[model samples]
Target chain A: MAGGYVGKILKVDLTTKNVSTEPIDEGVAKKYLGGKGYAVYLLYQYIKEYELKGLSPKDIDPLGPENVLIFATGPGTGVPRFPSPGRYHVMALKAPLTGSIGSGNAGGKWGTSLKNSGFDGIVLEGVSDTPVYLAIVDGKAEIRDAGDLWGRNIFDTTRVLTSVVGGKNTSVTCIGPAGENLVPMAVIMNDEHRAAGRAGLGAIMGSKKLKAIVVSGDQKVSVANPEEFKDVADRCLDALKKNPVTGEGLPTYGTAVLVNIINNVGALPYKNWQTGVNPDAESISGETLSEKYLIRKNMCWACTIGCGRVTNVKSGPFQILASEGPEYESIWALGSSTGVKDLDAVVKANHYCDELGLDTISSGSTIAAAMELNEKGYIPEEDLQGLDLKFGNASAMVEAVWRTAYKVGFGKYLALGSKKLCESYGHAELSMSVKGLEMPAYDPRAVKGIGLNYATSNRGGCHVTGYTIAPEVAGIPEKLDPLATEGKALWVKIFQDFTSTVNSTINCLFDTFALGAKDYGELLSAVTGWDISEDEILKIGERIYNLERVIINRLGFDGKDDTLPTRLLKEPMPEGPAKGQVADLEKMKEEYYKLRGWVNGIPTPGKLRELEIEV
Target chain B: MVMPIVNVSAKILLFATLRDKYGVRELEVKCDGTVRNLLENAAKTLNKGFLARIYDISRNKVREDIIFTINGRNIKDIKGEIGIKDGDRVAIFPPLAGG
Candidate 1:
């Protein structure tokens, strides 16, 4: 067994109530590493099997029993002193919202506990006639009836399951009312509030009738070259501690630190991206959150940079005794984008999303789109059922969150996400989405590279896949002209490919702000006893990215789907420092396609062969 | 003929650690029409340590880690030659980002 790998995979077929185990393939581990990379390979193999049976990848229903869901971690995960190794990646054959290859990564104790419980990953297949949950304790796995646990919110579900499983390191990952109701924007939450929060994979679990997965154990991840691993880890840790981003800024303000910086740069999308600046930004910024609501800082297991905010609203209608975050994206999604400046209401709404097991980005972005639709008078007033679905109506915004979770009233449309919701209301152009998934807080109109990244991201309008903001806005590694398109395609491609590799390592993306590709190569080589190089690391990442693209292609997406919303391309930003600026996507995109060796989003045969991807 | 060095006031916006350290979000200062002049004047008004914190005394230039922008344009984009005008928003942030 290689260092950091648990050597076995747990497979459960809910339909037949069968539990099986498989040994980790050494060749696959070598090529794909683990986590997202390994899982993508597995999903592609499953798609090939479907093809053999004469079923097209497009025929696979996202919410159907045919879709496969995977929970995977990398060779770096769970190892002691591995920087932020407390995260895991989840992938499904398709996402209910995007219909592209479903992917989400989350941080907390769950991933680490699973590895400690003697498994490298878990593969969930088929559907159950009754509600069930998987429990893995020590080295044994079992499927137990979850009849009593269904329909509970995420908090209660996690609490009940943890007590039932009773172990020193037990952790639970599960869906809630939103998932049980099969809300298309539902998320799978673990460790109380940490979420695999995009692409609605929770609904996939809901469709499978699986409620939760409980894991607990005391197994320590073995390190192959302890002396060299320690030396490399110590050097990386020093770098992380020395870097201002990973060391001080994040520790002081949490992720919401970007709220003000991005706003100042005139890239903070507001009121459904009608503009790029929010005048009331300070009230919801990281500095304000630290000043007013914070109880203390929180962190994932084995994480050194404690960026998580433990907070409370103290005394208000939106008051809560305890909560975790309305991180930068959450604050923007629920607060600025919807024009709700009330931090209390934003916190309350964010908490509701956590409890109800919802993706904060999609949930809030969908509501923002609806707000536009309502303001334009396109939505029938009767459909609202007296709810004021207007921008800046903080109270109504808070009410909309729970309604969407339960799929009640107007939330029925909101549950379909922004793309479908806007299209259903005769105003598809108002949706501020790309490839059916809602984009994050960054306005591509203000930052040219992020716009290109949004259009070309494998999992739809995602920032984390390739956060060009680091270079374009926050100026990590280096600074670039936010409005300039020159050389942005190459930057976006490198960031995207590098991010793919980082996700497979299954650690916090924040680590990359301090550690570079060479550091990762050294760390992995030391841990796995493989002489990995920086070039090889990037190559593996490119292979994983291309394979994911292949899966999406089979699912009926191509170059045409690689696009931004019409508003970003045509409707120039109206105000702020970036006034009159629009995302010049075409120039950058043409160069991007050429650099990628892709023709209209599909990878060429030569490119695939170069990456060692089996066609 | 020589042009008079007229001092113009610019709005200074600070964020993250800079804000916490200085205990102010925005300020105004007069400078002789350049980003460097504006920063230098603002540093005097902010505190003695402000200049020391953002400038590399040995290199005799603004520290590489400091993110200085004029009206949302990074100073690096302009090769540090961007001239500041009256009421221009000059925001200074330390190395910081989160997704």
Candidate 2:
């Protein structure tokens, strides 16, 4: 037990209705830090233990009782002094979609509440015979029947749980109908809208018959040296305020500001990756949103840089009450990718996704793939059940969101996600995914470094895994030629390693725009009483990354799996600044593997030994 | 012997905070000199507060945090006394970021 961490890990077995607590080893904490780092290490340990008992690693079902769902927090989480301490939790499991290392990071009061309620992390194993919800109140845990809450949308579930559990202070994270139906795009949403939205961890929750987790407590998180921690925290805060991206750009316009910028560079993915530019990009741009619909800005707990947007289309065909996002990714996924320029329709779709507990990126991208298929005559009008499934068909897009959540009609196929849906129709190439998970907003061909990051990402097709866009587009730290392949492998390695550490800290990734690796090291050192240096902290990030790589490799992935979609490699950008350019994935993959000390995509024995990872 | 020189017109696009403050997404700025001169002209047009955010008063250099791009290329890549041509799209952002 040490300062910063609550020092207790809770393990709940729903099948046995048993709960146990254990002291997290200090050695393990120092090595993996926490959040994604701890989750990955613990998951690897679990898988290894299982394999020792004769179950093959590849045979472990992602949705079976064997799969472990982890909700983890880091030492820096819930610390008031830390910049963006609001980001305090990460959800990790064997993703049903990618079937590899699946993880998602989120920000809100939930993580802080969980930590304050007296646990650093909670691990759920085995399946419950009946639907249940876990409630942690003042350091004690209980499993309650969730028969009444099972099929409700996230918003309704949160409201009902808050009333039944306690009061306004109770933070509830729950899955909606999408999760209950085991839709692969399901997201676990908390605070009504914020979600651990990728990898279908929500579906895992569904598979376990678990509904929601509500936590509320008043315990204070202590630091080893409060004075030292405050000083470093202040410096970090000052840096954030002084940085234009964090202090001004983000807080003011939120993430949607990138629409025009990305489109201007011709990096915005449109119409299922057929092109890089969107003619109606400006119509749904952040500027337009701010001018027309933004009601106010929002933030997570302990966050000074408020980048969250609360928007409302007060009166229109797409009108609805004020709601939380339609962030840049959602806008791109539902708008540009689907070739629908109606901002209100996109916002409406975003609202539906949030309410239904779906990952907007996967859901929207899935619809886009279906649109392309329908247009190509792969899907007949009868297949859509009289619904005109065409790109830019706003009505169809809105309806698809609702249907996909409920797995109704053609939506049943959409529920399988783009990769599965496309494969079923014998057009997997049109899916625009890697490792079965749909791609995010960034166009790989336009941004070569990001393309490499996408292909080799442990979680599959994720931008946050290694956001090369900072250097490639925003020029944070330093500007790199987006088209250049030389030295990109080295950059991707650095970014990926650094991001692993950031995710482990459970802090908002936006903090990196202002703070450097040393700043994070100083914050952690003050909180944990460890004299950690910048390079040492970065090494921990590298170790965590390599550990995840080992887990995926052990599960049967190799260099062949580390690849972009065929369209990204074979098809050139048809127009705009990126016209005629394609991702040089092979070249970057070779250099990336070498830099990672990996043979093919698997970590070499020496590399494993160097990182102190046991095979 | 002296004739007045005509200024070149370039479209200046501001994003995020700059856009919010300027009250317009894009504007046409006329400058007959280097990119620095165009920025200075924009500073006068948008107000000095905007310029103070992008330029360092003490160093007399473009603030490192200001991401200045000309026709989708970073100004740093273009090299030397960056000149702006008529109808060229110059995008100036205040360290903008998103996923």
Best by DockQ: 1
* Docking class for candidate 1: medium
Tens-place lDDT per residue, model 1, A1-615, is: 888788899999989989999998988988899999999999999999999999999988998888999999899889879999999999999999889989999999899999988899999999999999999999899999999999899999999999999986899999999998888789999999999978889999999999999999998889889999999999998888988999998988899999988998799999999999999999999989999999999999999898999999999799999999889999999999999999999999999999999999998899999999999999999999888989999999999999999989998888889998999988999998888889999999888999999999888999998999998887788888888899999999988888888989878999999998899899999998888899988888889999999999999999999899989999999998789988899999999999989998999999999999997
State residue A256's C-alpha deviation in candidate 1, in Å.
Answer: 0.3
lDDT of 1 by residue, B57-91 (tens): 67766789898878877778776356889888888
**Alpha-carbon deviation at A346 in model 2, angstroms:** 1.2
Candidate 2 at B25: error in angstroms? 3.0
| Candidate 2 local distance difference test against the native | 0.87
What TM-score, to 2 decimals, does candidate 2 have? 0.96
Candidate 2 lDDT at A558 equals 81
Candidate 2 lDDT tens digits, A485-577:
999999999999999999888789999999989998999999999888999888999999998988887777788988999999999999877
* Backbone clashes counted, model 2: 0
RMSD of each: 1.7, 2.0
How far off is residue A296 in model 2, in Å? 1.4
User: Which portions of model 2 miss their true places by more than 4 Å?
Assistant: A167-169, B1-4, B7-9, B29-63, B79-82
How close is every model to the real structure, measured as TM-score? Answer: 0.98, 0.96
